[model samples]
Target: MAGRWVKPEVFPLFAAVGAVVGLCSMQLVRNICTNPEVRVTKENRSAGVLQNFEEGEKYAQHGLRKYVRGRRPEVMPNLNKFFSDPK
Candidate 1:
């Protein structure tokens, strides 16, 4: 019988590593594309130094961060509210 080159037991390990690497790469790309500090357009690239510092500061917070900033912190908000109700 011909011997198999790769054992099947290691497939899950390979998949997990690949998933981590893919997620990291995608996050890096997303940051590069959306970050105000890292301008990518031609107009933005040619702007005078310090010209938009104030504007940049306005959008400095990441989208997710801005959304979460106004939210109340809770491990499980729905569950906590349910148990804490006076009914």
Candidate 2:
């Protein structure tokens, strides 16, 4: 059946590497999309926090688009106040 475990000894090392490469490409797509900054090498996008829902969503959409377009994210995170993070 599908996904049956195959004995490692049955395949050459290169075969294992090829299979890994195929699987890794899918992971790469996810990793590329998840970053607020769509930039693959830089942190250009960031999730923004705002006091109001309208403003917060506005920036979130901006950030999301930046990555989707392969551009840098301009989202500005909340900088107006600070709170002790939950322990």
- Candidate 1 residue 65 C-alpha distance from true site, Å: 4.7
Q: Which candidate leads in lDDT?
A: 1
> Tens digit of lDDT per residue, candidate 1, span 1-87?
334535788679879999999999988897687656676888987874655666576657667789899899987999999999989
**Candidate 2 per-residue C-alpha lDDT over 5-78 given as tens digits, one digit per residue, 9 for 90 to 100:** 46566568659898899889966775577533344543432434324566445546665476668633435334
> Which 10-residue window of candidate 1 scores lowest in summed lDDT?
1-10
CA-lDDT, candidates in order: 0.78, 0.56
Tell me model 2's lDDT, rounded to 2 decimals. 0.56
TM-score of each: 0.48, 0.28
